[model samples]
Target: MDLMDLSHQNRINTQLSKQKVGKTIYTDCIRAENIKQIVPAITQCIECYPRFHRAENPDICIMVTGIPNVGKSSLINALRRMHLRKGKASRVGGEPGITRSVLSKIQVSENPLIYLLDTPGVLSPRIENVETGMKLALCGTILDHLVGEDIIADYLLYTLNNYPQHRYVQHYELEGPCDNIETLLKEIAKKLRKTQKVTAITGTGKFSEYPDGFLFH
Candidate 1:
């Protein structure tokens, strides 16, 4: 969900484009303004409208599936808006698992009669690796607390460093790239004055203050 930055998204997509995906995955970047291309793309993908030669067959039911928080519902709604000029028929949210179950069919088009089946985002039972899981978490496919924000933030720091994207360092007014998560968090906390006071156990019948802020507030 943090893919709000178009440049960052384009860079990430460029890196992924270098890797292999299936036999030949067609690539296209459609912005919100280019909704016209969506219908053509779907219609051209033979898989989208298979053999329904019968005179009165049920309307084409297209099932949308993906990892959580990838905007499946929004896509359906957008297509509906473009084709049917209708309001949203499915719920859209900024978090994962917005659609809890298989939702009833919603018509998206009138001519060919396209009905979209909105299903809840499904994740594999087991993630391949920690980094893969971290990426999923960073993309909001997984809940933040499940992976721990500190770890995710640190991973973000590492990724930014690996990408040589020091725009953060300039934004935070830091001296330079920092490899230490705690040190970076400390510097950020101090700069933002975002510290929480709480008791910390010293394990010697005593306690100390605990800090509770990170990610530049």
Candidate 2:
């Protein structure tokens, strides 16, 4: 199963179509919490698989795997809540490497007797290009520090401007869309009040500003 943010719906669909994989189901496991679409789809898959039909119980065991910090554990928990009315069977976090090892099967359903095994996220041994690596870093699949925050921030700004996504203009109250990162950062710092006073070498206090992180909302 793959977990994705709905905001990138068009890009996700286009990429998936190029892979030639059949019968893929998309679900917004975190934001929309739409497990209602998943249960029936999973049932249909199991019904079509001949090996499951030969078994007397026909219990289903699904393995959840994806890139780091892509919400495999969150999906398991959501499914359990939807089907069994139970609390979390797995731990969740905002950063990657939260689930380091394979977890034992956790029951999510009773009637067909469904269980899901949560596994650590994996990445390809080789990345095709620099742009792909940066994209992964932006998605939180890779550690931000490894790629350097400045580069990620700059690439993000470039992408936003390339797409001409102007929400940032209104959010930060900028005069208009900007191509310069330094100018945009200053505006953001001022808007968020993230400036601090520090003593200079000449024994004079000077204010330094830093941009604070924010969600698009």
Candidate 3:
């Protein structure tokens, strides 16, 4: 089947799967404006999709990573609808870590070749440290790319020493106690610089640079 057909089938399947044994399942379809907002990002990825599809020397492997409830699944869903205009093959849910193994090599088109790796969400290995959990949560499913060695080290130290609260001192912008999305994006940018430096020297840079203003609305 074509990618569009597969996507449509996936969406239908998802709706069917959500039907409760006794309870009714109500579907609130996505709004047009929301779809419009995510189109550019999806289009940007689509342009690079074909390269990843090529058998050898793929140009880019786009990995959508982010914290739980930060709209990773929603964003992917939007991309699927806008670009593929079909349903999803994989199931999506509110519970964390639903996307457990890597989903490799989904062809957006035959010629260009684009691949997407929808990985399991990042979670705290253990619940012993709340700070560690927060950091893991912040790093999202694609922590390998979103975080760098030095930032990881600093995050580890901060978490281990119970200084996670300090992350908000100057790095984060909180209105009262709630985090501001703009602030989060700024912090991420700063962390990226530190992480890249470490990766350059250590040969561990596998993460891709995120587009500017990605974390903000």
Assess candidate 2 and give its TM-score to the true structure: 0.79
For residues 1-217, write the lDDT of model 2, one tens digit per residue. 3534578877777888899644566655754445777777788877876777865676788998889998889889988888898999899998888999998999988876889999999999999999999999998888888998878888999999998888999988889998887778877877787765443343356543333333221
**Tens-digit lDDT track for model 3 on 1-217?**
2112355765766676688322222222266554554434544655564554555664444676645544555555655665676666556765456776777744332223434566666544566774665455444433433455445555544453463354454454433322343444455566554323221233475654454424321
Better of 1 and 3 by TM-score: 1
Say which prediction, candidate 1 or candidate 2, comes out ahead on lDDT: 2
- Show the lowest summed lDDT stretch of 10 residues, model 1: 21-30
Q: Which residue pairs of candidate 2 clash? A: none
On the 0 to 100 scale, the lDDT of residue 18 in model 2 is 93
Cα miss at 62, model 2 (Å)?
Answer: 1.5
Per-candidate Cα RMSD to the true structure, in Å, reads 5.4, 5.2, 21.3
CA lDDT of each prediction against the hidden true structure: 0.77, 0.80, 0.49
Candidate 1 residue pairs in clash (backbone atoms < 3 Å)? none
Q: Give me the overall lDDT of model 1.
A: 0.77
Point out where model 1 deviates above 4 Å. Answer: 1-34, 45-50, 196-217
lDDT of 1 by residue, 11-128 (tens): 6667776884212222222355555665555555634445764567755677988889888888888778778878989998878878999999889888767788999999999999
